[model samples]
Target: MSPATCVFYGCRHPVERGMSKCSHHRNRAPCSALQCHNQAYARGRCVRHGARKKCPIPGCTSYRRASGLCLGHTATHSAQAKARHLNLPPSTQPNTTPPAATEAVDAEWVLGLEPMDFKLPPSPSWNALDSVDLAIIHILLQDTVA
Candidate 1:
């Protein structure tokens, strides 16, 4: 037999006939906590009855993610959320890590950290790239468009 929607008009949950709330509404179950009543949210209980998870950080009871950790706890997740808030793709977000020192101090760098879609031709100071190149790179990056 297929499950049906709850008989309670305000409630929108669906339930099987033999699940927790069969007495009041065979379609949807009520929370399973004894003598404490509210509609079941999931896992046979309501949020107040611990149907949902709490953030893993000690003493936190507010919001939580599926991993049961609080949001913004993960560095990558926080960065992604910031990118989303600013309407940018996570990939396009600016890199926070300082670029690793180049192995070729005197080598003329015509390419970017990634394979440059467009290479910069050799220039006077561009060779033996050091801190100054960062300003030039910043300018180039600011000017670049997809």
Candidate 2:
């Protein structure tokens, strides 16, 4: 009871219609490309766009999709490349997190030692601690025996 469908170009062969192809040339319509499902117009290429090339990155080859970088570098270099390619100001680039300071004070604090352990109370920056402190601490400990 239903109409027949056509299996030609731009055809929509519905099962109910029972048409071999769509409205287009059912017999003349060539097969779709292997790489793509679109109808093959020229050497497996549609009229609008052709088969895309692979990325030029070290080990990438999944369609030059975006920048010279591939899917792998898409997250890493895509944005950066775009910015640079557009000749944008360097200030616009994202800032990398600075490495944590490795000063001795930080390490000592982590160990949970007394404030004095880190030369607490902040030693006199201008004056260096000389032998005077040593002498005072060990003052006259030696005896002059007869």
Candidate 3:
């Protein structure tokens, strides 16, 4: 007997062992948030709405870390907090030193210093070719000559 297929439109996958719908189309309790179709994780809401721990920094919507700050803000805040605890004066001056310029070397100078010798291996003679190889060569030569 043929395997029972899912009834969902356009789906050809076999149904679960006893269920009417395929795994993909199986009935599930959706997220509590309106208009969302994702499966619920906790409190009848999806991960994004129910379990996500957002960064506490105002205006930042990034996910929170163990320190309760996003990756970028965590380092900045930690450094600043440490500096304040150490009683270090706040830096006010901007970096004024210009980056060092790199000089371009001429490719011709290197090529002139050492001339490269490229010698190709000698090609096999026509006598060393098989019948099939000779036939292909003959066809190519005929095309070129024409």
Candidate 4:
């Protein structure tokens, strides 16, 4: 018997089942991998085959970018976000006074108190004596006494 016919004109290949038409006749679907969608520099899309280059920023997807940002506001917005996260004063914050020299303003002060280190404190053993001591402390305290 002859092999199955290609849906595409002038082609003679077996069409895969469940697909509407043969590969040649069908439109090429773009790669679904995130690799095809560039995330760096805000470029969340492949240049040629990708769509949905919408900016990942909340509520803002005006234009597509080779990078996610449409070139005009990427760096500016990113730096501003970083500053916000680090508790540093926003660069975009409008000042009533004339801008001060960068060095004159204390960066640490602007950023606020230093973040607490993440180290865990030493774990104390919870034994019978600790429980007994806690019970005694509870018992000694009267309800009315401050």
Clash totals, every prediction: 0, 12, 0, 4
RMSD after Cα superposition, model 1: 19.0
lDDT of 1 by residue, 22-101 (tens): 44566456678887557777899877787887676678675677655665454445445556655787579845432234
As for candidate 4, its clashing pairs are 42-67, 42-68, 43-67, 43-68
Pick by TM-score: which candidate is best? 3
Question: Alpha carbon lDDT of residue 7, candidate 3?
Answer: 61
Q: Which ten residues in a row have the lowest lDDT in candidate 3?
A: 92-101
* Runs with alpha carbons beyond 4 Å of true place in candidate 3: 1-29, 33-39, 48-50, 92-146
lDDT score at residue 70, model 3, on the 0-100 scale: 85
Q: Taking the tens digit of each residue's C-alpha lDDT, what string does model 2 give over 42-74?
A: 555654355456677767646665556455666
Stretches > 4 Å off in candidate 1: 1-27, 33-38, 72-146
TM-score of each: 0.30, 0.29, 0.36, 0.24
Query: Regarding TM-score, does 1 or 3 come out ahead?
Result: 3
Deviation from native of the Cα of residue 145 in model 1, angstroms: 48
lDDT of each: 0.57, 0.50, 0.64, 0.50
TM-score, candidate 2, is 0.29
C-alpha root-mean-square deviation, candidate 2 = 29.2
